[model samples]
Target: MKKYGLQLRAPSQQKKAAARPPLPPPRGFQEDEDDDVEREISRQASKNKALKDVEEQHKKALEEDPSVFDYDGVYDEMKEKVVRPRVQDREERKPKYIQNLMKKAEQRKWEQEIVYERKLVKERSKDDHLYADKDKFVTSAYKKKLAEQAKWMEEERLRQLREEKDDVSVAFSAISCDGFFPLREEERLRQLREEKQPSVEQPKGDHHKRGGDAVAAARERFLARKRAKLSLVL
Candidate 1:
């Protein structure tokens, strides 16, 4: 059984053993060292070529435009001729009706503003006139004159009031109380005293009672008078 097993080994193990080939011999140190040197040399050559290409480009640019070497001058020159966006002709682009309407609106606005300014000036002038005194001048003498005039006017008013009061008092004294005898000076003084005296305080209910009593008394007196007249007629 062992011999048969050996002969019938796995096909994968046989394939693996057959697939691998023998490796080549190790490289020499000198050859490896030569390869490193060649690689370094090639890298340096590439770097130098790149630098030379940049230098040549710079030289060509300077020859083409000497100002290219002067960066500030080149920048300034470009800036001076900067490309701006073209402005559209809105007047030409707009419809005729819209343009006419806009022009009319602008004219109307200007007219309205003018009218408003004129109105403001008129109003300000009116206000200044209203607040300012036409006859008064801005001086101490003028102020003193105005004060004296006001004082004279006030004194005249007081004198007129006193005269009117005296005339009223004289008229009151001449008034006859009973159609026969005019009020004497003493009687007038007494009446004035009575008028000045404080009235007696009465309760609200008493006021109504007093008023009713006075009305009844007056009615009785009127009846008496009517009876007396009737008797005289008979």
Candidate 2:
């Protein structure tokens, strides 16, 4: 067994993953535009061995095995540290259901419910010791600054809402004046009534003219009413 060092990425890390190597064409296979299905299975075993080597190295560096490193009053994994969980190698573990595993797989890939761990790198143990003591001070300042920011944010949000209300009121008045969109039909009708003109008066004296006009007018009205009723029924 060999010891190795673990390097963890910081929050500010923004590096992209390294580009994959160009793939070779499959052996005894034709090279069509969509012919990437048959991989060279011969190389898979080599790839697996390389992956195992890397995993072994990572375990030596980061993992706390069951039988290693027992210290006094404190188990050392992180700072004054702690004993990590005891992992066991089992020969006969029960197989998981495909549907449940599929659901978990979906969650892990898309929703990120699956947690991944990376160890923090310390330049020196002394620096870690300092942070443990002053974390409360840092936390307090951070909280106060957050509170101030939230207060301003809330105030601006309310101010925006008030401006929106004023805009709505102005738009209502403009639209009603232009008659584009009637916000309140009752209000529009009331305004129309206020701006109404008086009706003209008609003469009422000639008997023969009045009798003929009244009979013609009554027949015309009856015909108009009949047409309207017929139209409605149709």
Candidate 3:
């Protein structure tokens, strides 16, 4: 019979499988027992063929290159290079290093516990309402608010003063000698009476009283001058 490289079954094995009764539901709950059996046989055959191929390739490689696996005491050399030093280090230094690490860990844990206990005690002893009274703490924000309020008040006062001064200037413009300088006092009186009139309203404030009084005095003086002029004319 001709040999096949990777046959799933030989001709005699195929004849025997055909002659045997149908496998009894594949020993498990498979719906298609024939297909499941064929697939399982194919998988096993492939696995065996793959293992055989690997073996043949390994033998061919060894035949072609005999020096491929020439260890030549390399195992001993690797052991000396890697394993011996690690073993010696473990014997000589690992124990002491482990002891020092454990000591330092214990010391660190004790220090942390002490610090935590001290913090807990301090918190327990301290007053709960230490920062309750907001007014007791004069922060920069509070100071800034006071400064803004004072500045606003000062600006308001200055504004009122400016208004009062403006009113006084309007009421007594004839008294101020900016450009009008009459040669005779009588002409001056006439000019004051004719050209100047109280048109500006008085500002209402405690500081504006002086300006109001000045305006009233100027008006009274103008009236007096007019009366005297009238008498002289009579």
lDDT of 3 by residue, 1-234 (tens): 998698685456344444667665554566577678999999999999999999999889889987656677667787789888888988889889999999768545544544555576578558647756544556898678557545754654575567656656766563333333345788678767865786565544643555566667766765654553344233
Error of 1 at 108 (Å): 6.6
Question: After aligning candidate 1 to the native by TM-score, how far in Å is the CA of 141 from where it should be?
Answer: 44
What TM-score would you give candidate 2 relative to the actual structure? 0.22
- Candidate 2 — which residues are off by over 4 angstroms? 1-137, 182-234
Per-residue lDDT, model 1, residue 187, is 84
Tens-place lDDT digits, model 2, residues 111-226: 22111111112234546776776644347876675575457546545755675555555545544444456449888787677669565644534644544554455556556545
Candidate 2 lowest-lDDT run of ten? 111-120
Predicted structure with the largest TM-score when compared to the true one? 1
Give candidate 1's total backbone clashes. Answer: 0
Output candidate 2 Cα RMSD: 45.3
Candidates in order have lDDT scores of 0.62, 0.53, 0.64
TM-score of each: 0.23, 0.22, 0.20
Model 3 steric clash pairs: none
